[model samples]
Target: MPRMIFVNLPVADLPRSMAFYDALGFVNEPKFTDETAAAMQWSDTIVVMLLTHAKWHQFTDRPITSDGSSSLRLCLSLDTRDEVTEMNRLAGEHGGTADIDPPTEYPFMMSHAFADPDGHIWEPMWMDQAAMEAGPPAQTDA
Candidate 1:
C-alpha cells in the first residue's frame, strides 16, 4: 500500500470543524468518522483527522492550545494560482479566517495563508512544474 499522511488536529467543535473542512473540498470518510472524530480526506495520500478535545486527550496528555499559536503550518498544493486564491476565499466564507498572512509570490510560485476556525493554519500554493524542475533563478548581485 502507498504511504499516507494523516494530520490529526484537536478541534473545539467537531461538527463545525467537519463542515469547515468540507467547504474547503475535503471529503469525509464515513467509515472512519464517528461522534468524536472525523477523517477528512484531501487527496489520495492526505487526510486530516479532526478530533474532539476528548478524543484528542485520549491520545495525548498535553494541554490543548486554544490561544492562536501554531508550531507548524500545513500546505495544500493546487494546479493554478487562481485555485489558491479561491481556497482562501472559501476559508473566510466558511467561518474561518482568510489571509492570516500576506500572500507570497515568486517567479514560479504563489501562495496564501489562512486559518481554520480552530486556528489551524493552512497555506494554499501553486507552483509551475517546469519552472521548478529548472530550479530557481541564479542569484545576481545588485
Candidate 2:
C-alpha cells in the first residue's frame, strides 16, 4: 500500500470546515466522518481530518487556539497554474479567505495563499518539474 499522510486540524465549526474543503475539491471519506470530525480526502494518499474543539481536546491536552493565528501552513500542488488560481477562488467562494497574500510567480511555478474560516493557511501551487530541475536562469549583466 502507498504511504499516506493524515493532517489533523482543530476547527471551530465542523460543518463549515467540511464545506470549505469540499469547495476546494476534497471529497469527504464517510468511513472516517461523524458529528465531531470529518475526513476530507485531497488525494488517494492525502487526507485532512477536521475536528471540532471538543473532539480535538479528546486527543490532546493542549489548549485550542481561539485567535486567528496559525502555527503551520499547509500546501497543495496542482497540475497547472490555472488550477491553483481556481482553488483559491473556490476557497473564497465557499467560506475561506482568498489571497491572504499576493500571488507568487516564477517562470516555473505559481502559488496563491488562502486561509480557511478557522484561520488555517493553505497555499495552492503549481510547478514545472523540468524547469524546476533546471533551476532559475542565470542572470547576465547587460
lDDT of each: 0.96, 0.93
Model 2 bad stretches (over 4 Å): 135-142
lDDT of 1 by residue, 1-142 (tens): 8999999999999999999999999999999999999999999999999999999999999998878887989999999999999999999999999999999999799999999999999999999999889998799999
Clashes of 1: 0
Which candidate comes out best when scored by lDDT? 1
Model 1: residues with Cα > 4 Å off, grouped in runs: none
TM-score of 1: 0.96
lDDT of model 2 at position 28: 100
RMSD of 1: 0.9
Model 2, 1-142: lDDT tens digits are 9999999999988999998999899999999999999999999999999999999999999987758776888989999999999999999999989989999998789999999888889999999999878988888999
